[model samples]
Target: MRTYNIHEAKTHLSRLIEQALKGEGFLIAKAGKPLVKVTALGKPEASSTRRLGFMAGRMRVPDDFNRIGADEVRKLFEDDA
Candidate 1:
């Protein structure tokens, strides 16, 4: 698209924002008519692989989840007194 008019987008604003962060989007006129369309903002992409179960069955894992607090933690280390 490459338009850049306002004084060549203020003298090539940092190489047109590094070519619009590499996706190459452009258009910023003011006297030639366009207006603004710099681009580059959709960034949600950082998964690096870590989806073991992702909540498999959605919920429910109580097989005494490690002995549901085993007898009040064995009576707080019993010494009964």
Candidate 2:
């Protein structure tokens, strides 16, 4: 880390940026108090691509899964006289 007064920072802005890109950071000060820290912004992370049926073989469905509750489900909705 390095410290620079306002004038020095302004005079050597380009050099400071180059240093920052190389992973060196510095602080800029006004009246001997640090005003801000200068550093490079890191590259963004890559996003993963989406695929359909990504969990196709990860789980199994029982043979009677769909018809297991058919009759009770119909009685709940039908009116009883």
For each candidate, the alpha-carbon lDDT, in order, equals 0.85, 0.91
Candidate 1 lDDT over residue span 27-79, tens digit each: 89897999788888777666645588778899999887999988988988995
Q: After superposition, how far is residue 29 of candidate 2 from its true place, in Å?
A: 0.2
What global local distance difference test value does model 1 have? 0.85
Q: Write one digit per residue (lDDT tens) for candidate 2, span 1-81.
A: 899999999999999999999999999999999999999988765433446776889999899999999998998889585
Over the full model, what C-alpha lDDT does candidate 2 score relative to the true structure? 0.91
Candidates in order: C-alpha RMSD to true structure: 9.9, 9.1
Q: Report clash pairs, candidate 2.
A: none
Off by over 4 Å in 1: 4-22, 28-34, 45-53, 57-81
Best by TM-score: 2
Q: How close is candidate 1 to the true structure, as a TM-score?
A: 0.29
